[model samples]
Target: MPARVVVGVVTSDKASKTRRVELNRTVQHAKYGKFV
Candidate 1:
């Protein structure tokens, strides 16, 4: 299998050596057949 590259955004950077990252993606539900 091959790896996938996802683009994310840095939401916060308040801590000295810590940061917050946010990634948005769409996923399909198994039973309901809906995208979430």
Candidate 2:
């Protein structure tokens, strides 16, 4: 018989509310100018 195990990092580096808002807004604005 054999056993297998798996692990991974399920977390976010940005956890601050204000910073998260700023980061998301910046990304959204940048993507808005990109032509897809």
Candidate 3:
């Protein structure tokens, strides 16, 4: 297997030598089978 690269958004950056990242993903609903 190969290493996977993930991309996300930086919601905030107000710390000393640190960063805040937000990773989002969609999951299918159990009953409706819809991805949201």
Candidate 4:
């Protein structure tokens, strides 16, 4: 298999044991516009 491109955001880093990651995504709307 081939490697794919991925994007993510770090929401929290205060924890010493683990990290919190928030996946990024794009969405299109007719009136509301684009959202992350």
Candidate 5:
């Protein structure tokens, strides 16, 4: 159980970073009409 919790935390940290990057890129594209 503890191992699963630790793994979940690590996976979430990675996923959040990727999601944030994608969201930032999309917003920048919408504003500038170009890929950022």
Candidate 6:
């Protein structure tokens, strides 16, 4: 499989070359089948 590309907001970029990112995704509640 090819590498998956994810786009997200950079929440923190203060720690040298490291960074923190927040990804928004929805998951279906198993039994209820509702997105969460």
* C-alpha RMSD by candidate, in order: 2.3, 12.8, 2.8, 4.2, 12.8, 2.0
lDDT (Cα) of model 4? 0.80
- Name the candidate, 1 or 6, with the larger lDDT value: 1
What does candidate 2's lDDT look like per residue over 1-36, in tens digits? 559444445345566552322121223346568533
Can you give the lDDT of residue 25 in candidate 1?
Answer: 90
For model 2, what is the alpha-carbon lDDT of residue 2? 50
Task: Give Cα-based local distance difference scores for all models.
Answer: 0.94, 0.41, 0.90, 0.80, 0.38, 0.91
- Residues 1-36 of candidate 1 have per-residue lDDT tens digits of 659888899999999999999999999999999999
Q: Which of the two, 2 or 5, has more TM-score?
A: 2
For TM-score, the strongest prediction is: 1
Which regions of candidate 1 deviate over 4 angstroms? none
Residue-level lDDT tens digits of model 4 in 1-36: 659777788899898988888986777876879664
Among these predicted structures, which one has the highest lDDT? 1
List model 5 lDDT by residue over 1-36, tens digit each: 465321122223346446222122223477668856
Error of 4 at 3 (Å): 0.9
TM-scores of all predicted structures = 0.66, 0.20, 0.56, 0.44, 0.18, 0.61
Q: lDDT at 32 for candidate 5?
A: 62
lDDT of 3 by residue, 1-36 (tens): 659777899988999888999999788999999998
Q: In terms of TM-score, which candidate is stronger, 2 or 6?
A: 6
Off by over 4 Å in 2: 12-36
What's model 3's overall lDDT?
0.90
Record all residue pairs in model 2 with backbone atoms less than 3 Å apart, i.e. clashing: none
Ranking by TM-score: 1, 6, 3, 4, 2, 5
List, in order, the clash count of every candidate structure. 0, 0, 0, 0, 0, 0
